[model samples]
Target: MSARSKKINNMAYGKLCLLLLILSGLSLTIHAKLSSNFYSSTCPNALTIVKQEIAKAIKIEARIGASLLRLHFHGCFVNGCDGSLLLDDTSTLLGEKTANANNNSVRGFEVVDNIKANLEKACPGVVSCADILAIAARDAVVYYGGPFWKVKLGRRDSLTANRSAANVFIPQPSFNLSNLTSSFATVCYKLYVVLGLCGHTVGFARCTSFRPHIYNDTNIDSAFAKSLQNTCPRSGNDNVLQPLDYQTRFRFDDKYYQNLLVKKGLLHSDQQLYNGNKADSLAKKYAMKQGDFFKDFAKSMIRMGNIKPLTGNNGQIRTNCRKPN
Candidate 1:
């Protein structure tokens, strides 16, 4: 081989290496922005502290509502105590409403307000009131059998509320199982019905017993009606939750499917994943093979948060979370 040809080959090889290196760096950058895991060497402690406080407040409020409902419905009747039906804030005058109060209707407002006030006092301008409510509502849902995913902080409140966004974002209680799954998928949740059932079954089952009297509202009876009436109620209240229980409820897992297996999964789609041929068959497959669903759930969640997020200096870094000027 000629020396000139050899030198040309070497040059081409070096160029290829350089191109690959650039691509690797680009991939890392994109990954960091997309997920970041709320972990960063350069993450501001103040930011982290604020985020933690926000999450804590949200989690606390959710659990509080859960406890309140649980206490209210102890040994309830067939129609249950209507714990959910009783949740309302029509009593509060609109003139005195706060961001958490007027914008979103939390089940337990008084308790949520106290914590919100504490955060307001501690960090007046650093956090957004919208996020406080969003995270709190999310945790409350988690408290009610929905598992938690890491909520991306740094989102600012809307100056003018988008009613369309609100109306479109939240799923209805009366939504069927297929509709529920479709709604989640419509919002790009990347939910694999089969992948989530393994760890979800137990929690879902407990959720079932939590509202034995909550037969009609939400997806309570229809989804898990057969399992709830057959195994859960027959076995007695003490035997409601099983040993493989995933308790945190804050973390995502396959328990959703397992939950379907044990309780009255309220949604038609959810029930289908357990017994029917489509998604239910897939869920049944996973119930047998215990694998991790976190990776998929997390990836999907990050994508959810990123939807229409402020990027490239488009939004402001508000010193005050409310009433951005």
Candidate 2:
């Protein structure tokens, strides 16, 4: 072909790619119409129902709050927070709940079930499971002393769960700084920063998740590693729990960033934020100014919750969170 023809073809291809992206964006969110008062008319008690269930669970075990928040974050990564992560494994579908990243790590399904049962009773098919999950995460953060933001709703439940996507999208505890940044991309590294500071502030990691850090990693403080080594160890006790923040594991604060400043991060991925990188400055700022961290965290949560939500006639509203209708 002539060079002029080739140039025309390339320009046409570029235009086609851009047009496809534009259409994709419209299909995903053009009709989302998410708002803080989305449920005021349809299900007035939607947020309240979710908050009550989360509070009841947190009352039983404070760590359950973290689990719910984690559920929301993980769900956002794969297929844009369509509640696919909540689906139970079945003969026809290998759901995300059983995926490598979520298998034994993610928890608090019972609390979600309780919330869904109540929501169904009050307003059957009015609220989407994805929206409930997002609201539950916000309520958990507020109940645990983190910043509160109005969670926009209107998302619909995904009909199918992509287990393969779950395994690939969710960031692992063993990731380094570069991995963390790239994994948290599209939404920007700031999402990683706020989550690392806010989520880990109240969350805990499993012994297996941090064993490599406490044993083989050199960046961690010696005393901190030694202490964790006692709780976690070189082998066995895989389910043993260790607080992400050694000082205050139940409070959602900037102390998780502070811990990183002293090389006391509980997981290999946690310390990556403070280790001579672009994220180091962010970690330092949050460590020194917790109010700023809280403010940014609240904003980031809202932004993260809105990514590519299924709306309009795109997805269905699942009655039971464990399965689609």
The CA lDDT of each predicted structure is 0.37, 0.82
Off by over 4 Å in 1: 1-43, 51-157, 181-186, 189-253, 266-272, 275-277, 285-291, 318-322
Given candidate 1, what's the lDDT at residue 46?
35
**Residue ranges of candidate 2 with Cα displaced over 4 Å:** 1-31
lDDT of 1 by residue, 163-208 (tens): 2332443333334444434433432222323222222332223433
Residue-level lDDT of model 2, residues 105-184, one tens digit each, is: 89999988999999999999989989988999889889988888999889999999998988887888899865655565
Looking at model 1, residue 324 earns an lDDT score of 41
Candidate with top lDDT is 2
